[model samples]
Target: MKIALFATCIVDAMYPEVAQATVTILRRLGHEIVFPSGQTCCGQMHINSGKFAQAEPVIAAHARAFSDTDWDVAVAPAASCVASLGHQQPMVARRMGNDALAAEAADIAGQTYELSQLLTDVLGITDAAADLGSYFPHRVTYHPSCHGMRLLRLGDRQSDLLRSVEGIDYVDLPLADACCGFGGTFSVKNPEVSSAMLADKIRTVHSTGAEVCTGGDASCLLHMGGGLSRFQRTGSFEGTPDVTAVHVRQTSSTDVGDDNVDHLTAVVGADDDDHLTPGEKGTSPAEPSRIQSGFRVGQSAVHLARILASTKEDPLRVQSEGATVSGGSLR
Candidate 1:
């Protein structure tokens, strides 16, 4: 399979490791990976921000990049970006009175896949451990990003893969399908509502007591991670340095458990006030943190294919899986 890797703008700019992991996993599966450099933002930010006119070229760039490529499928680690390709791109094109561009955008989106969609739907991969040697000995809770869950309709494809990872304690999250409020520009435009939603999410994450929170989109992870960082900063969250968020952006495919797991350690235990940059981390001192202690925060990506592609033995032990509690239990 010749797969064109559409490293979304966020992944390209902030989380390049995720793109590398995506490539590493596909290559391990004996598939060739293609990088279409012409690709840029999927125009999701512009469309979401009501800048339809500005989004036209971004949509054009994405379509043109994929149009120039001769690959079986185009894949992105972020579900929101992939969803934008299919959902927003065409709408923006039509709104701009560019029917041809709309048709082109639709064609491009039809061939693109979020990582889990490509792995499970296209490649017939189900069990990460049996098929990819995915081994992560940690308590994990999954938060399905809004776009992936509602827009892309990915269902349990991502979580099912994580559940299948060797030595993984996959716990169910309360409101697993709820939005993390990182609607690209939506968070920036509406900070209070965004912060409220984030507080609820962090509270639920704390209830799970999972060492890490895994999701399908880097943007959401960034939002959730920012909320967690602020909670840690103001001494709001009273947890240990173990809980972190892992955006299965390509998942543990590169080194399965080790790299992402190690990355999580860095994210959660980071205490340098300098590390708590406001805009970059997606947090602010104005927002009150309700997350308790023994629940630090971090972020990473784990590739599903690489979890089963390796020849190494499975290292998971299925420790007590923590269930995400919401509502009354939250502080």
Candidate 2:
């Protein structure tokens, strides 16, 4: 299959690794990956901010970019962007009385899929460890972004794939379906409300005791990561920034850090057999221990693909940037 990559603005500028990793996954599956050079933002920010007039050109550009390319499917790693493509783009075009653009936008939206949706539904990949050789020896909790959950109704597609990864201890995040409060301009225009929502999300993540928090949207991840960074500094709810922000870093296996001696040894580089429960060892089952969660978010397709790729070359580890936990940095 020939796949065209719709590298969203956040992933392109801030999180390029996620885009590259996406290519890695598709190539490993023996599929061709094409990047349409004319691509830009899907105009989600403009549409969300109630600027339909300004968004038409963006939506038209998106449709034109893909229409000019020859590909079987167009996929993006971010669900929010995918949601905008399907839910917002055509609506915006029609609102602006661009019937031709509306039809084109609708056609493009039909062919677009979120990374997880493509992998699971179209590619029929049921086991990440077995199919993709995914290995990450860290406890992980997943956050399903609002657009993916409520709008797209992705419904556990991301979490299910993560759960199937080899050597991974998957924990259930409390209120996993709640928004990270990164609704594009909503975060900017409603700082106090956004922070309160983020605080609730961060608290739930902290409860899971997992080292990594992942989701389908880079924007939400950026919001949550910044909140974690600021909360660690101020030590209280002091102020809020009514503006959008993002930080990105290139990460490899070595960035997981050496200071976490016990956790590093226990989870990282462990064999598949090491994950077996006591019941499987001919012993009485021990009571289940609750895992505390952290503030990691938005690994997207590349991050997920590299986890599998690491199993073949280097073992996967966490980085202190781009969705780092509390007391960690995102750059």
Candidate 3:
């Protein structure tokens, strides 16, 4: 398949390595990649900040860029951006009263996808370790960012892909659905709340005992990594600014996600519990866990009526930044 790479602004500036990794993984799989040099921001940062006005031109740019390109599928390493395209872009255009542009944006979104989504759903890559030459020989925990989880409704896709990776010891990310506090411009606008959330996240990540925190969204990683900085002993920059903010990094356990160590081996203390966002679906969470009760497609929505009724009357609050389409999995 011919793929158009969505080098999200964050990846272009800070974590090109992620784009490179994405490219390597795809090419090794024998897919052709096209770099649409005209591509720019996906307008997520603007739209998420409530700057929908400023987001107009960005969305148009994206529409024109991709519309001009002829590729089998457009793939992005960032889930948030892909979610914005697939889900938020139409709202952006319609809100601006650009019905024509809104239609165009929606069309583009329909054709684009998050990397793992394309791999697992379209390409039939169910086992990463078995297929992708992927080898991260370290104890790693996966954080499914809010947008990817809620907006894109991508559950288990990222985790399943990681689990398929060779040499990867995939441990369950305690409170995996909890926000990493990177809500686009949300962190800058509401710094305090963002910090509080990040602190809670740091605590959970540290408790996981995983050496690395990996996720598809760069925004969340940046927030968590920044908070980890203040606690760094020397206070030296851990990675490049964009690197610190975009690419996944080693979160400091000194304050949040770290438990401790017996010299070389790091460890998360016991007392593991399931604390997914106040509400949202979980991939068979750690037991005694609460979830968004209704299934989407695969299974019959047995209590669908009650779940819909309750959520409508008292909108179940979700702590995470995402939610997937109902019942798309069980099918």
Candidate 4:
């Protein structure tokens, strides 16, 4: 089968190894891989930030890029970007009153698939170790991105693949469905809230006692990894007291009602100093448990594609920077 690789902006610019690992897996399966050079950002960021006018051209260009490429199907490693192709692209085109472009966008969306969707649904890959020679001998946990879970409805496809990996000790992440608080610009705009949510995710990841936290979205993994790295470096979470038990209501807008605000305040409790934010400095702190003892201090955040592409001979190694696949370093 001929497959076109849609290396999303993050993957292309930040983590090209993910794209390369994706290609490696496809080629290992005897499939032809084609990278459409005209492809660029799918405009997910623009659309997400309400820049519909800016997103229209990007969505159109994405459609044109894949349309110009000759392939049976297109696949992207990033679930959020892929979800935007179907969920937001056509809407943006229609919002611009471009019916023809909207049609093209829908057509492109139909042809595109997330990596796990393509591997499991299209290619019928039930066992990663058996089918793709995936071997990751480490304690790993997966965080399903919101776009992949809610928009794409990619249920258990990624986790099941990870579970099938040879020598993998797959542990279910507590509150696995919770957002990692990296909603692109959402994180930047609401830094405090985002940090709070990220702290919650980091605590749960630490609880898992896993050496690595793998996920389908590079953006979320990047957020979690950066938070974990900061925790390891600073040895304390200052300026994030709300992170102790503050559950940021996952809503579209900032108009959280009194009930929600009350709920948020109610959940805030005094815990160990490790869990408390800087604001709760005077709170009576409990003894630090194993989850806070810096056991997985240098825990790695890896993309699922890299894990899937790993093998016994050419295993993906976790480095200080990130994971290296096939001896090629990722920047």
Clashes within 3 Å, all models in order: 26, 10, 19, 2
Would you give me the overall lDDT of model 1?
A: 0.69
| Per-prediction CA RMSD (Å) | 13.3, 13.0, 16.8, 9.3
Across 1-331, the per-residue lDDT of candidate 1 in tens digits comes to 8999999998787656567767876876789998987888898888887899999999999889889888988899988888988889998999899999999999989999999999999999887777765677677778888888888999889988888877777778766666776788888898777776776676567656676676777788777767665654564533322224332223475675664322211133223333444766633222222242235344222333233333345232221233321211110
Residues 1-331, model 3: lDDT tens digits: 9999998998787556567667777886899999887888999888777889999999999888888888988898888889888778899899999999999988878888888888888889887656765555545567788888888888898888777655556678656787866787777888766665665565455444554556776566656555544423222222212111111124565687585432111112221223234565434212111112111111110111111111122331211213221211100
lDDT of each: 0.69, 0.72, 0.62, 0.82
Of 1 and 3, the candidate ranking higher by lDDT = 1
Instruction: Give the distance in Å from residue 125's predicted Cα in candidate 3 to where it truly belongs.
Output: 0.3
TM-score of 1: 0.74
Candidate 4 stretches greater than 4 Å from native: 243-294, 319-331
TM-score for predicted model 4 compared with the true structure? 0.85
Write down the lDDT that model 2 would get: 0.72
Between candidates 3 and 4, name the one with more favorable lDDT.
4
Distance from true location, Cα of 75 in model 3, Å: 0.5
Q: Model 2: runs farther than 4 Å from truth? A: 234-236, 239-309, 319-331
